[model samples]
Target: MLRTTLVAAMLLATTPAFAQPEPARVEVNGMHMYYEVSGEGPPLIVLHGAYMNIETMGAIIPALAESHTVYALELQGHGRTTDIDRPITYQNLADDVAGFMEAVGIGKASVFGYSMGANAGLQMVIRHPEKVDRAVLASVAYDAKGWQPEFLAFLPQLAPEFFVGTPVEDEYRRLAANPEGFPALVDKLIALEHEPLAWEADVAKIETPILIVQGDADTPSPEHAVAMLRLLGGGTMGDMGAPLPASRLAILPGTSHTALMNQPELLKALIGPFLRGETPKGMFD
Candidate 1:
């Protein structure tokens, strides 16, 4: 009996400290939302790019979980969440996200998203600002015009074949209820991207402080990003006598959209302060 107890202790001590429990599933708005909640501070919600799910941000989520109750979710039709016939619109997705928060009992949280997730984050701020404390919108624009001509042209090129044998497909198949429906999900996102989407006027209504993260060569030109800031009362020249705009913008040099998600350490360093309601100094470099 003593030897058995000693063996169990050895096994327990060797287990990794940072290992997170498996995601828990909850039904919200008729969709099964699979989310992993970790850490024990203020809540931070994470949304991933289109055609991808929570795992796409895998590298970054753990670091964020260090100081936050990271509510990383698989949106409807993404990852383990089965799709409904309602179609995949940003507005509907935002509603789903809002409902998820209510079901999980989170009041207001620091919402952060990348690519499709970023767009969804903006939609959340628009449709459900009451539930959002701070927001991070990365690698996205407010409307069709915000995306550059070349990037706009690149949307149709995102065929299912492009993701075959990649991590995106592997992760999708691993957790998706219907792995065969991956192509259809890709089609829906492409069609949505092609459709004329405009919300620049809505930007003025978003009173929530937002941190805009974009790569210098991202799909939306830096000028378009600046325009977003202007609407958020950021681009105007405020004197040292006054407070800086609640909205903060970061345009990382030599960074591409693909490179952005891959650099969790860099993102953590830059975003840590903003999440805490502090301005990040010298992020342009």
Candidate 2:
């Protein structure tokens, strides 16, 4: 998937404005997984947030593709991937991601996920460490308590109509393999959100370099974001002559979880180099 710089540019030239690379399907975990492959260089699997699909990451992919082979997957029940009768959980989705990577013959790659996708990204590192070299978790927390009470309280009250005027509803209607399944997907997610999260120990055990990004005013307060980072070896002063921690944290100013995709440039600045095996400019330093 490593392409010369000129080749990367050519791919862009051929891609129309606001369109992603054409998607390909694979069988993973008994589901027909849909993924879009683009860009050139090391592989980077980009996971979209719950209730969204590849298009959610559309604004960010073109730039990211300039330097990496981007594998954007639509998880089970989201986008073109069909849902099963099983309960929706990050652990199951993480397994599907692992199977998808294997199906596509990608042995190892950096993974990035936002919001619910962020939850999955962290799980990928914990559940399938061999397949991920680094991970980026944005707008999420590893524990249920990591979320603000207001946000937690509002989960069960969400209805599909609540997103009617937004792109979330529009896209779900547009790209979901089973358009009618959107409502079901929403309910499942609401239920999942209320369940206790158990990622602190898993995250603490992850040795893969990670970048934790969040919007200052987004889900889980900045304080909780820092707490998660601490568990992942970030947000701490280093001992004299000690090795620098592999994890980094960033809190985007004036950002919201729902608004993350719009600020592609800032996200690219914070994460681009880190995926390339380079130290990202420390946002917290």
Candidate 3:
């Protein structure tokens, strides 16, 4: 999927007007994390994908900013944030997110995370439920097995040299506090991809409302998305007298994991109402 993301990043030329908000740095989880705050209203933290930064999020940040105060972050080893000794596991990243919220004075906030960010957000909702009001997890999977076979096959072959001439490498060198650490960062992330993780039971117990978004042709299998929805109290026949589930699922057509970031209008239309607790109106309702 990193290949898909590389192509998408290369295609992304027009940066959003709100993309360059002055970033603030804070010490969170023993790392100097860089984040930018924009818009107004309730706090909403936007997390970027693997090897991505806030600027790579495209127009989605401004779209979300229209309603919520968007706090876009560059996680460990990415963007302006320098690397630490710790491995890039979801659990560690989730803890970093919780610590960041506390440092920023946001007791509870909604989360919008994509790709690796989404997986970390899932862990956050499971491990630190009290800190998250709700979440939007895009292209997320419960375990490594949830990914498509092709994507799984591509992981072991991933190397830093694969990104040398790509935008991901270019952006890393352009914004990283330690630009030379790009190879190390890529190595750690590849290790993360190989790490085992399964949270079905944990996900089933989460009380926080969640919206699972994925593309029909994304890395995470469609079956896995549906299974995750079921775990989140979704996948019910609401029109048949069953109550609406606290969580929801959205599968965007003609979109890939990388292309999902480019769909600002579609994402805003779905995420805005969900975060505001506005349920969709049906004929039966």
Candidate 4:
């Protein structure tokens, strides 16, 4: 059961409610990155998880597009973007996103990132704070220890062949500029999984308002999520009269990493108000 669930979580694919619009290309960090923009309002950058593209973000794109101009990106070798020689790391991906925004004329925007994208968004918040307003980080872990032990144990066994008949492979073959490089991409991502990822110290220094969204059964353990909230100055007793923390945490019941992406309605409800800076008024308030 753990292996099966981990496989699905690694793929992170979801059926799109609608076909993606034509993507535009921009020269970013020595690669021609692909991105699509939709709807209108405040600028919001939406990033996909590992082995995922803009289409795999599922209904969340449309859900967010209704309230914000959604800039859905294909990072590095994923989706329509071709492989570059540099290793796939959170820092590199974050740098590419920052450069992409600069090349495309967006000065600053809110970011909503999931899984691998979430890690990159954390880097952006830490390494390039001036370019982000607010951020929504979904299914992320600050360090290797934050991952559930079972999930961490399963990472070493990952191989491209395991995904051959899955939607992940199908989409890669359909959209990757260099389709035959899928195996190489998987290898790079595998190395990425093994890379050191301790960022709790950096996270403690972040000043940008962020929402940490996790599934009850996510790869990052629930306790780790709460620890992250504390690092972000969250986990406060709001009704006790103290000021609310700049960050917030949401754990969806009965959801896994993959399942979390499918909960577009719930995500929209949490994300819209966060980005708009709308605080809900309660009777106690």
- TM-score for all models, in order of appearance: 0.87, 0.86, 0.94, 0.93
Candidate 1: lDDT over CA atoms?
0.76
Tens digits of lDDT, candidate 1, 24-67? 98998887788877776899999977756565555678888888
Best by TM-score: 3
lDDT of 3 at 179: 79
lDDT of each: 0.76, 0.75, 0.85, 0.85
Evaluate model 3: give its TM-score.
Answer: 0.94
For residues 1-285, write the lDDT of model 2, one tens digit per residue.
001121112222332223358679998877788888888899999987766667655578877887888898998888898888777788888898999988889999999887778888888888899999899888767877777777766666655465444555556778777777767876677667666786777778878998888878777688888887788777767654455678888888886555555677888988887776675245443
What digit string (tens of lDDT, one per residue) describes model 4 on residues 10-51?
A: 455566764355569998988889999888898999888888
All models, RMSD in angstroms: 10.1, 7.5, 1.9, 2.5
Residue 161 displacement (Å), model 3:
2.5
Q: Candidate 1 — worst ten consecutive residues by lDDT sum? A: 1-10
Model 2's TM-score against the true structure: 0.86
Regions more than 4 Å wrong, model 1:
1-18, 156-167, 280-285
Clashes of 3: 0
Model 3 clash pairs are: none
